[model samples]
Target: MTNTAQPPQQPEIPDVLSEKKLRYVDIGINLGDPIFRGVYHEKQAHDDDFHDVVQRAVEAGCEKMMVTGSDLKESEHAVQIAVENPGLCYATVGVHPCSAKQFDTHAGGPAALLSALEDLAIRAKASGHAVAFGEIGLDYDRLFLTPKEPQLKYFEAQLDLAVKVQLPLFLHSRAASEDFERLLGARLPELPKRGLVHSFTGTIEEMQRLVALGLDIGVNGCSMKSEDNLAVVKEIPLERLQIETDGPWCEIRPSHASAKFLAGAPPMPKAVKKEKWAKGLMVKGRNEPATIPLVAHVIAKVKGVPVEEVAEAAYNNSIRMFGLGSMENASS
Candidate 1:
């Protein structure tokens, strides 16, 4: 809840990249145990399933992938992937609220969530490449398992950890954006000016509020389907935006271009046709880092900038926000 660091004046990063020079840095991808194809569905498949799919993602455009793990075990797996993959992969450690439903304990359930986060925090600090605190926030929509309190507890704990470690955060908030805002209203995490609220599906008011609090928004393919968000992109200065595919999970279907994919995933072409908030494909459950460029294309169209410029800005913004600039190997 202390004052977050103020962001510096925006740098003049080039706005576009040539077709062959396109390099994507996906801020979100889940290539672990539960590969969770696309945006929402958890992978219930076998252990060997994601290797080929992830290889495809790597071959596509994902230069540096930040994988999000929903719980303790999954987080461990995500970290392992980053370790094995070296400079090509990165992971964030935190308990995603929706998946922590059974995490209650006696003597203040909040303590239990905090305790779990402590472990992730330690692991994250040790894993030099695990750069952020993520997929952490409230979800009023998924009320069946986790109630508001536990969700809030996990979110606050992760936020505090992020502040303590000087890492940025990748946040997730559904219908609870307001609640998320209330929790972070005056209490912005004391992070270097790089924290972001991922896949922002909230209203303009909520977007404005988060921006006011010194946080940026993660632009996934789903944001392209919403009129509100499109307007948000048109209005909210691009300086507050960053690209995220939320891959191996929320990829928008109908590949933006004919970049034939070699990865295996559930074919849910209808998902993108819905044209509502989800667009079925992107938010359905089968996303990967290879889908980053496609998402970036849509973001460029919405902002009326060349795809090259949008990609470059998003990449540079991500570097500046997550402290990747200091890492000698953190470059395209």
Candidate 2:
């Protein structure tokens, strides 16, 4: 096991505050987790665990969280959270192609996953709450479970489902940009309602494809170290951008090595609640939705906008992209 040396903690925020007052959304959060790699290792996401984190986020200036649910059950859980939380949270339902590789009890594996995904989509639509079809796309880099071909197979299948449902698509393209672009190219006519590419860390050409496809780019901890990502972000307009913590699995850190150390602890359940910034050099242990104000802080420095303005713009873009009604209703 890694040295469970607790990383430093962040300051708490006042209760009677609205991040809407500033203007940002930590839109992409994995409130329910299986503890994947990268920025999501601080919180132990078993089945349904989020109240504490949600409270922290509200205080930290993040008024909205568009959680990702990669399968039927997770999607249902996300919807439950949305319904329970009312406006602070919303959800996207889809079978992430990578996770879809595990679809079982079927004559054809890939086909089974697609069928299952379609069923989930139907349920979400029937529930009348699913905002988008997401956490679905290509990932040819990590050889975590199955091979690449199966992932590609179901990715297209889900893309087809998105078109059929006429819902926005929230995608995750990792080390499979060209393949992703080719598949997306074929789905162009229905691309206007396209979704965002979570935790974007690809090349300029890939970024171009994202922009061309009308998809939004999500920035998180890994983005902290990439000048290339910042360069791409600089070129991409704010409307085409978004932010996420992807927590309880991938803990975004101020630096890389630190991120690695916290790469296995369930996303920190929550930081303490209060109303002041800690003095001195800030050390990080876990990443949460609330930690996003710091992300907005950085983006503001780069985009040359007031931190509050960036927060609000990102917040509105998130609501607009995800079809989540309004930020005020969300955060309130």
Candidate 3:
């Protein structure tokens, strides 16, 4: 009989809190998502508290955040956010796989659309508003939003653009690792600063493959949903691991496997329903960069390390990958 491999058991480790305040860099955030502006599903529900949200994350020790761009408009907005915030925020410019069909439906035509994306990336990089080029890759699980063909075609096209833009990538992959790796692998030699695969929830094998290919793995609440997820987090090399809130989504829930490790984490802001939102209060179910420490805490617990170690490593890894320079240099 053949035996299947099992996930290695993680030894129990005591959760410890360090007196030193650890800094973090949230490598992926949908800061331009309308939800941040009190708009949901195309309707304004409350006052825009964007600055307040940024304030909370700052108080929580999240010194830098990468505003994610999942499409052309979002990419433009991301750059603007970075420019306005300066060192506190940076942007990633690229279309997500779920939005790949926009290439076909764009009024400017596919060639013009790709050209525009390249233009944004190049311009933003010049001004230091953009750090990575992505949120682009394959997402087979959400084929309902976009067909497999366009996803494949546009993913390849974006890879070419990444080569031209010469920025580190901010990639995504969901249930499409085969084609994802194949396409990325072909372009590896040209992309010296191979980027991260954010919100990763893949298995040990997949994680190892990406790491072997010189890419980083980003972890968030979605990346720690189950026992299997914890195992994957444990195996991630400290140097190659980065953390993100992936917020306004991927909030850590009470039911998540990572929640058990949050016993000693810093207290999150008081949460209120969006309708009852007030200054300094977190919207009840919405995630924010303020929760980045909780992610580091979970990884530390699962890997039998100190929270500060995880926090420091993730912060440095993110800064290096995004080419944001030293935190001090960034502020100056």
Candidate 4:
């Protein structure tokens, strides 16, 4: 038989880019990832074009972005990125559940590791480089990366850090809702500003429960992968909703359920395969903060609201949640 298999189709990019500049705040991005620095799998594939990436995002109306620190080293790097960029970028410092093992394995032991994280958060918060405390929480779906016990233990421990610093949280949870909810509930009273459960791909009930507990939900491409996800997103209260790119990762692809909504939204620039990367172009498989508008477009479509309504609501909710200050002040 002749080979009947077909290569995957590339997502169609609209010919015209959106001219309506709507401001956005990408709540979660892993900027410390080597991909942003033009490194791929431990080797350099292209020149470091991090500034180019930032500039493209600004043109896309993502005026501010929060860089996620998945562990100690990345957390430090995230603060550095925020410091260097000033108001343009902020950092979230914490050990993701996947890296929970780092606590016990640290040279100075778990207490010392926690102490170091506390110190980083304190200084960064004072300097306004760190706006939230996290990228931390449970991820049972990938338990192979970490066990449940330490995830639970240190998730609570970090909650304590959040209380100490009095900063809002940038949280995560996947296939671990029971313990995630339980732990967060126990600490909710202590965290006045609450936090956001980002990249939420949970059931409507889970979303409702978290909202009831006074938390906000963050959506990205990965959060809208299927019809069920769209249904859940539609029900999220406008005031309780926020947006993020979770970038260098969750770009809105043509294959996602959100793609159909991209019909009339802003068009992304040309994308080249990583090996053939150039300035002013996006890497084919790498997501960037610039595509944040597509995320807003999808949410607006699913919720039957205008794209502006979604963008503005998400922007205000993020500014309020992360204490980014009034819109006028922020834009200034």
Candidate 5:
């Protein structure tokens, strides 16, 4: 007698597992930050040092990225990088609150600084490489960087510039929520509807207030610091959330670590070995845009949603908030 048995059926794939690899858009990255320079090994004379980082990011599924502009010079550099890379990158043009003092010290003082920023915004926008106006807002946490008064003054000036340029705002706020809320709230009616609070580490109440005002929330390592923070993350509405690496800083929080998140992350290029990282830190100490998927993974775990869902919502939300046209256009 001959007997035959069918092979045991394979387990069905979960919808999340069946989906394609999650493509991402980093809504914020300081690609021009000095820390990024020489992070990779020295290359040949003809090599484009920065382009290597961009290539690695794309390979890791971050198809598009918005290089943050924290000041006038950095904003110019960010725009230049974006222009050089075209569809793969874009920029925000504004002075950070920390750099607010530049306004007073600039050649013709605050008026000249404001005029120059306006000129940059106008030029950056015309290049089809500028997506917003910021990295701007109040940051009392780093008061040493800029006194509260200057922070507020320049923040207000940049808000006015954002209004004039009609670009979405890439806002920053820390430890000065009361003042931040008051100032931004007063101007809410005049600001564009598409702005976001980047690196948001605020309370649920604060997050709610921002969402209520039609602003999206940008999450990164800094935003996931504690159980309380993760709890707040769970409360954020999917459509109102976006993920960023905020690289060279804000790697995923230690408490929220998971190998699963890093599974999709791109490996450090051979040119940059683990031993080369800055002292007293792991290889991840220098965060890169490629780690964005890890950010999505942490969000998925905290919110009890599929990673794919987090990735899709974030990718789409970024495109919508930044008016990145279409994924095809933005990622081309």
Candidate 6:
């Protein structure tokens, strides 16, 4: 009988580094969203546009990114993208609170929906590219999309699933702090230690509670919307903070008008540069992973830390939380 033994596989090559260049990790980006389609020079191929976005992000010093998965279909696509890109990208697998209706009994029932999500999570984990389980949590602001009861039900289920899978979380919360806090607080001991409250727009008191719970806070354009939000941002400890784009959605508020904020803004990548972008289909201020530096810049100014310091801290936090092994080798 012939032996069919195969040799051990070598790890993928890490991003080439320049000693002077700072590396950043966007802990969240919805790259699979259709909003990005045709935004890059009216490109017809989504794969090409996606690659362009990744390349530009790398060039802009965003060395790594976590593609968010709001539902099972998006989660599958996210994992595939992460697998295809290897070192540059990772994925989160979960259902968003707004889409809680999909898991409702009236729709397809929680058992079927959750079973599908669990399978996707297992497959994603096996791929060596999935980092967390989320875009999951409560979103009372969009209760019209899904009522409160089902949203709570699904959030609890996903939390339990995260514990089962032993992965970190990429969480969301908006205008639903009471129930969000209560549900999450009940499961605090059961959930993974390294979870993020992505795109946090909560009050300082709420932020403090989450921090006390040992969860990291994700700051994006929405988090910097007003003086009230800026005040909340200022109160967040540097050690507990991470930055994200939440792209094709949250761009830095134009109303900020601070020279420091404007100065820190990253320029548009040449890959996506075009005189005219697709109307209506594309957002007026389309955020992308390449703009992570800009988010970092805003964070630095708000935190009163150097931009490089903010970048390094966020990068370090992301790698530590997500267990991104490739970056450990690259950083060393």
The whole-model C-alpha lDDT of candidate 1 against the native structure comes to: 0.63
Model 3 RMSD in angstroms: 10.1
**Clashes within 3 Å, all models in order:** 29, 23, 0, 0, 0, 0
Off by over 4 Å in 3: 1-20, 325-332
Candidate 3: pairs in clash: none
Candidate 6 regions off by >4 Å? 1-20, 39-48, 105-108, 257-260, 264-266, 270-284, 327-332
Instruction: Supply the global lDDT for candidate 5.
Output: 0.77
- Candidates arranged by TM-score, highest first: 4, 3, 6, 5, 2, 1
Q: What is the C-alpha lDDT of each candidate?
A: 0.63, 0.64, 0.87, 0.86, 0.77, 0.76
Error of 3 at 15 (Å): 23
* Residue 155 local lDDT, model 6: 96
Tens digit per residue, CA lDDT, model 2, 191-303: 56577888877877778777877888887766655566666656657778787777654445445422332322222222421222132111144356766766666666656
Task: Give the runs in model 2 whose Cα sits over 4 Å from its true position.
Answer: 1-21, 34-49, 104-112, 126-128, 249-252, 256-284, 327-332
How high is each candidate's TM-score? 0.75, 0.76, 0.92, 0.92, 0.84, 0.84
Residue 224, model 2, lDDT: 51
Q: In TM-score terms, which candidate is top?
A: 4
The local distance difference test score of model 2 is 0.64
Candidate 1, position 124, lDDT? 63
Candidate 1's residue-wise lDDT over 19-85, tens digit each?
2446667887766634333222443332232444454444455567777777767777777777777
* 226 Cα displacement, candidate 5 (Å): 1.0
Best by lDDT: 3
Candidate 4 has a TM-score of: 0.92
Model 1 spans > 4 angstroms off: 1-19, 33-51, 105-113, 254-285, 324-332
Instruction: Rate residue 113 of model 5 by lDDT.
Output: 80
Worst 10 residues of 4 by lDDT: 1-10
What is candidate 6's lDDT per residue for 1-332, written digit by digit as tens? 11112212432212332224578888889878765554344444332244445655676788788999999889988887787677778899999999888886534678888888888888777666788999899998998999998898889999888888877888999899888888888776876565999999999999999999889999988888888888888888888889988987787766753224657355553323333432211234667776677778877787788888888888888877786656463331
